[model samples]
Target chain A: MNLLPGFDDILAAAARIAPYASVTPVLRSAALDTLAGAELHFKCENLQRGGAFKFRGACNAVWSLDDGQAAHGVVTHSSGNHGNALALAAATRGIAAHVVVPEGAVRAKLAAIERAGAILHRCAPTQAAREATCAEVQRATGAELVHPYADTRVMAGQGTLALELLQQAPGLDALITPVGGGGLASGVAIAAHGIDPALDLFGAEPLGADDTAQSLARGTRVTTVVPDTICDGLRALVGERNLDALRTHRVEVITVSDTETIAAMQLLWSELKQVVEVSSATVLAAILKQPQRFAGRRVGVVLTGGNVDLQALPW
Target chain B: MNLLPGFDDILAAAARIAPYASVTPVLRSAALDTLAGAELHFKCENLQRGGAFKFRGACNAVWSLDDGQAAHGVVTHSSGNHGNALALAAATRGIAAHVVVPEGAVRAKLAAIERAGAILHRCAPTQAAREATCAEVQRATGAELVHPYADTRVMAGQGTLALELLQQAPGLDALITPVGGGGLASGVAIAAHGIDPALDLFGAEPLGADDTAQSLARGTRVTTVVPDTICDGLRALVGERNLDALRTHRVEVITVSDTETIAAMQLLWSELKQVVEVSSATVLAAILKQPQRFAGRRVGVVLTGGNVDLQALPW
Candidate 1:
C-alpha cells in the first residue's frame, strides 16, 4: 500500500515545485460572494502552467525524482489535464514524457498534450487498457510511472496549492475543492488541516460521479459508479490513498447535479469573468446548494482548471 | 470643449476610484510571449467590475460628483459595458442611474444594465437618437450626464489602469490598448507617458472600424466609416478630446482584420486560459502582425473586457 502524503511531504513538495509551477493569483468576485453569501477567495489554479492545478503535482512528481530516475523520463496514463501537465512538466526538466491516451478521448485535450511535447500512446478506452499501455511505455523507455492522482508524490505536490492559498488569503474558515480522483482534495486537506487543525474541509463532487460521497458514507472506497456529466475531468474513481486522506481529514463531500454545475459555470463566467471548466464549477455549485453550511464564512474555493472545449460549452 | 485629462488627473482618479474599482491583475503567458517574440504582460481589466474596464471610468464619474449632484443621480447613453458599469457604480453610492440604450441593442447587455439597478430608456439605434434620449432623461431627472469615453473624469478614471499596470509590471517598453472611443488608449497614454515619457504607445483598432487609423492618417478626426466587425465594443467614433490626447501622445494605430482578432482570441483562451472579449484580442493580433515593433521588448497589453455572448461566440 502506498503511504498517503502528509503535511511534511506537502511542505517539501511546495519547495520542490516552486521553480516549475506558477503561484497562480487568488481571484475574488464581489458578485459571486453576494450570491453565495460567503467570502469566496478563488485560488485560480485554472491559470496554472498547464491551465490546471495538475501542473503542481506533475511538476513536483517529475522533479522529485533523483538524477538517475529523472534520466529515464516519466510516463502517465491520462487523456485530460494530467497528460498535458506531465508533458509540460517533463519539458521543464528536459526529459521525455509518454502519455497513454485512451481511444475516443477529447481531440482538443490530446492536441494540447501533444503540443506540450508528450509522446502519445493510443490504447483501448478502459481502465485496464490504459494501465497496460502506460506500463508498456514505462517498460519500453525505463520511465518512472507518475500516476495522475493516486501517487504519493503527485498528492504531495497538489497540496502545495493549499500552502499558497493560505498565505495569500489568510484566516480562511473553510476550504473547498472539486473531488475527482481525490488528488487535489486529499492534498489540500493535509496542508490546510496541518496549518489550521480547525479549518473545515469540503469536497465538491458531481452527482453523476458521487463515488467519493458514497465511499465516505459507507466508510469504504466505492469504484462502481459510472460518471455521466459534462464535467469530463471528474470521472475518475477516488484513489485509495486519497480516500484515506479524506477520511483522516474528516472531509464532508457535497454532490451537485449536472444542471446545478452548468448554472454555476455560467455564473462563474459571467460574474468572475473566468473561463473555468465545468468540473471546477462543482465547488460553487455545492456552496450554492448548501448555503446554510457556508453562509458568512470565509471560504477558499480552488478552481481546479480552465481547459474547456469552447465550441461545446455545456450551457 | 472638455479639457483633456493629464497625468495629475490620473493620479487623483486613482485615489478617488481606489475604493470602488478593482486593481485588476497583470497576467503573463510564457507561450504567448514566445509566439510574439516579446515579453507580454496582460493587464486583466476583463476581470474588472462589470466584467470590463468601463467600470473604472464609470465609478470615477459617479463618485466625482458633489453630494447635491450625486443625489440627483447620473445618466449615460450606452448599451454596452459603460451602462452596466455606471449602474453598478451609482448603486455603490446609493444613487439612481438612468441608462439610455438604443433599440435592437443586445438583450443580454440591457438585462445586465437593469440587473445593476439602472433604469433603461430605449430609443432608435441611431447615435443621435441615443444622445437625444440621454439628454431628455437628464433634463427630466436633473441627473448629471456621464459620457462613456469623452468626459474628463471618465478618461482620468480609465487612466488608473495604467498606473496599476506600471506598478505591477515596471519597465514596460510599450503599452497597447484597443481604441474604441479612445478612452482607454488616451488615458493609458497619458498615465504611461507621465511615468515613462520614452515609452511607446500603440492602439489596436479593428479594420472594419478603422476610423481612429483614418483620422490619425488624415491629421483630423473622422467620424464616418460605419463599423462592421465582431468587435462590438470598439465601434464608437473616437471622442474629440480623446483624439487630441492620442495625437498629443503620438499614439500609433494598428488595425487588424476580424479574422486575425478571432484567431488571437482563441490563442488567448487556449494559452492564457482567460475569457477575453474579441476586441481585447486585437492588441495581441497587432503585436503578432508587427512583430518587429514589439520583438524582444516588454509590452503591456490591456484586455479591455469579457462580456462576450456565450451562445453567439465569434468562433
Candidate 2:
C-alpha cells in the first residue's frame, strides 16, 4: 500500500466518504477581507460532521477496510476531535471503536466520545502510555489501528476538503490550514497542488508548538519541543509521512503567538459569525501577521474545527 | 400606505435586496432533529450582512425610496440590530443615516452602529423620549423615518427571508420566529402563508415580555408589559401593524421563560455550531417546550441574529 496518498487517492476518498461527511459551506466576510487585505474564502469545516474536518479522514479510514478487517472494528489514541470523529465514523459502519484517551483530557471531549458510543480507555498523558494503551486495546479486540494523521487513508480523506473547496470557490491563489500532525496540511498540499501546480501551500503553527517549522528548517523531523499554547488541537508532533508531503509541496509554515491567535479567534467569531475553535484562528492570524505576503490574493482558509468548551474560552 | 405587507411586497423586496444581502444558508442538525423529534430547517439570518435578519428590511426600505427621498437619507430610533442594519443599508445608498439610540444600550451594539457610518443620537430610555429624538432628527434633516417594524415597507423587507426559506427548504409544515416588535414574525407570516396558505405560523415570545401573546388573547394590541428578560432584542412591545398581521394570520404565540431560552441557546451553540444571539433561541425554546405540536413535522425556524456580546453570554 502507498504510504502517502496521491491525487488519485483523494479523488477516490471524496467519492468514498461523500455519503457521510458534509460539504461544509464556504463563508466570506467583507470585513475580514478588508482587515487582511486579501480575498478570503473560508471553507467552514467547523460545520462538518462531528464538528471538525477529522471526520473526513476518520470516516474514510473506518469505511475503507474490507469486510473481514472491518468486522473486527477500529482503535486509535486521541484526546480531541479525532477521537470523537472515529467514534462517530465507526457507528456509521456498525462497528466498535476503542478510543485510548490520555488522562486529564478535556471533560467535554471525553463526554462527546462516549456519547458517540465509543468505549474509552484512559491512560497516562505521556505518548508512550497512550501508544501502549492503544496496543493493548487493539490486541484484545483485534481492531485495526487508525492513526489520526500518519496513515495514507486518513490523509487522502482529509484531502477531499481541497477538492470540494476548489469546486466551491474556483481560482484560489493559495490555501492555508493549521498544522497539528500535518494531516490536513499534507493532504491539502497534495490535492491543491495536484489541481493547480503553482498554487501556494501554507501551514499555520502555534509559536509554542512550532515543531513543524523547526523540522522544516532542519530538513528533518524534530519532536523535542513541549507545546504550551491555548490551541489544544495543534500540539501533536508532526507525523513523518505527513511531513514528507509538506516538504514535497514546499509548504510554508507560519508561527503565531498565542496572543495573536486569541485575538484572531475573536475577530473570526465576530466577523464570520461562526464558532470556530482557537486552533482554527491560527490560519487567519498568520495571514494578518504578514499582509504583504497575502495582500490582493485569493486565499482559501480551512477552518479545521469548532469543538470548543464555551465556558473555558480564553477571552 | 398599505400599513401591512402582502406577498407581492416580499417578492419585490427579494429582487431589490438581491444585490445587497446574502441568501443565508439553511442549516440542519441530526442531533437536534433526534432531540426534538422534528426535522428543523434553520434559516441562518445570523449570518446575514449585518449579522441579523433586520438587514433584509433595512436594505429593502433604504433602496425602495425614490431618488428625491433617498438623497435626504433615513433615520430610525433603535438600540439593537435595527440601528446597525439601517446604518449599513444607508451606506449602500451613499446617504446619511441618523440613529436615535437610547441611554444604557449595549456598548457593543452602539459601536457596531457607529462603525457602519450612522450618526448616533442619544435619548432617554423611554418610548416617548425615543420618538421625540427621532422626530427632532427627521425635522432637522429631511431624512425619512424608517420604523423598525411598524411600517409596511419594513415588514415587506423582513418578509423576504420567508421567500428565501420557502425556496431553500420547501414543504415546511410550520414556521416560527421570535416576536420583538413582531417585524420578522408578521412579515414571515404574510410571506409563508401567501406561498402556502395552509402552513402553520407561530411566534416565540419571552415570558417576561409576552405582550403579543396577551394581545392576541384579548383581541387587541397590548403595550404595557415592562420587559424583563435576558433576550434584550425581544424587549420591545409588538408594533400595531405587526400585531395586525399576527392577528390576521392567526399566529399562536408561545411564551418561554428565561431559563428555558438560555438552555435552548446553549443547545443551538453546541449542536448547530453557530453563535446565535440569546433572542434567537426563543423559537427553539418554544418548539422544544411543546414537542407534541412539532413532532414528526418539518419546521422552519428563523434565527433572528448573532449579535450577542460573547463576554456577557447568559449561560
The number of the candidate with the highest lDDT is 2
lDDT of 1 by residue, A244-296 (tens): 99999999999999999999998888778788899999999999999999999
Interface RMSD of each: 1.3, 0.9
| Cα RMSDs, all models | 1.7, 1.3
lDDT tens digits by residue: candidate 2, A9-75: 9999999999999999999998999999999999999899999999999999998999999999999
Point out where model 1 deviates above 4 Å.
none
Clashing residue pairs in candidate 2 are none
lDDT of 1 at A141: 91
Q: For residues B1-315, write the lDDT of model 2, one tens digit per residue.
A: 448987998899999999999999999998899999999999999999989999999999999999999999999999789999999999999999999999998888899899999999999998899999999999999999998888888899999999999999999999999998888899999999989999999999999999999999999988789999989899989988888889889899999999999999988888898899999999999999999999999999999999877777887
Clashing pairs in 1: none
Kept native contacts, as fractions per model, are 0.53, 0.55
Q: How well does model 2 score by local distance difference test? A: 0.93
Scanning candidate 2 chain B in windows of ten residues, the lowest lDDT window is B1-10
- In order, the Cα lDDT scores of the candidates are 0.92, 0.93
lDDT per residue (tens digit) for residues B60-85 in model 1? 88888999999999999999999999
The number of the candidate with the highest TM-score is 2
